[model samples]
Target: MSKPIIATTSLAGCFGCHMAILDIDARILQLIDLVEFNKSPIDDIKTFTKECDIGIIEGGCCNSENIHVLKEFRKHCKILISLGECAIMGGLPALRNGIPVKECLEEAYLNGPTVGRNTERILPNDEELPMILDKVYPCHEIVKIDYYLPGCPPKADLIWAAVVALVTGDELNIPYELVKFD
Candidate 1:
């Protein structure tokens, strides 16, 4: 029988969750026998595969591209998982939501020690740029999320458990040990 198709995508994140996915390591070979990666590390960008049984989305939606990718994933995948804290809770980048969008952009392009000077001449919010949402929203808020795995970057075990449960058609019961911060 053919293995299930799994598609993973990263939004505006550091790609740490994708790295953690590899943490499955030796077991990944076994997983390879049981799963086909349709998107992710090897495939930088892809139209969502209709054959995808599981879609893992890392990072939060901070830009139009991220939102577009997410909606496409939802339309294609049977089960969509919000992977890692960024997807689940907005992550570190979401902290910027507290600051004015202009201020944040200025910090990066107009006021930062190095790049600030040149940005003054740069056009402020234009048609080319996506508008920032008034507040950061978790994946579920934008689209229905089938499952969420939380953690700055979820542990390999969590990813493994989520997938194993998914492949076997079992419910994922996250243990307390995995969630306890201390």
Candidate 2:
């Protein structure tokens, strides 16, 4: 039998979740033996080359592009897993949920001290840029997420164990300490 295909993506996040996947150390070799990676930063695959058995999403959707990519994952993968707190509940980015979008844009573009010399007070309106959402939305809110692994960055042990179990049809050993929110 062939190994499963796994794809991963990080949307409105710090990439901490993806880093945790790599923190599995030597177990990563086992992962390589058990699955083929597709459309993941792990291999820098920019597009989905083929259908995948598993899709691991690491962050919430904060823009149009995130939604597009996430929907594409839902279309291409047999199973979709939300891999961290951000993907499950929007996390830190959701702090701006109640704040007005205009305020946030002003703070970043016009009023920010780092961006001095704003002679024209230009706010980014490029067609090439993905439009920011009024508020960050969790992955499940945007699409049908089949599973959630909740953590600020989910411990490497938890990720390794979960993926191994999913691939091999074994039971999960998710201890209380492994499913942290912070």
Candidate 3:
């Protein structure tokens, strides 16, 4: 039988969730034996080459490009898992949710303490750049997320348990400690 395929991506959050996946350490070898990676940064695959069994998203939607990628994942994968606090609840990036995008952009590109060198006072207007969203949004707000693994970056054990359960058709068994943040 063919192995289940998994894809993953990072959007607006820190890449910490991806790093947490690596925290599983040697068990990653077991994980590799159980599934195939597609369209994942881990394998350096930039686009989906085939339909995937699972899609793991690590961050929130903060720009048009993020929305496009999330939608593509929804289209190509049968199950979508939000794999960290950012994916589940918009995390640190959503701190800007109360602020206007224009003010944020101005502070970042024209008036913040670090912008002294922006003599042209230009804001990024290139068409190639992804349009910024009004605010960061959790993955579920934008797509039909099938599951959520919540944490600043979910515990490695929780990630491993969830992936194994899904791939193996076993019930997920997460310990209370694994789910606890404080």
- For candidate 3, write residues 1-182 as lDDT tens digits: 99999999999979999999999999999999999999998999999999999999999999999999999999999999998888998999999999999999999999898787888889999999999999999999998999999887789999999999999999987888898441
Candidates arranged by TM-score, highest first: 3, 2, 1
| Each prediction's whole-model lDDT (CA) | 0.80, 0.93, 0.94
| Model 1, residue 42: C-alpha shift (Å) | 3.3
* Candidate 3: count of backbone clashes, pairs at least 3 residues apart or interchain: 0
Candidate 1's error at 55, in angstroms? 0.4
Candidate 1 segments whose C-alpha is farther than 4 A from its true place: 116-120, 123-132, 171-173, 180-182
TM-score of candidate 3 versus the correct structure, residues matched by position = 0.97
Task: Give the candidate order by descending lDDT.
Answer: 3, 2, 1
Off by over 4 Å in 2: none
Model 1 RMSD vs true structure: 2.4
Residues 1-182 of candidate 2 have per-residue lDDT tens digits of 87899999999999999999999988888889999999999999999999999999999999999999999999999999999999999989988899999998998889877878878998999999999998999999989999889898999999988888898899987889899998
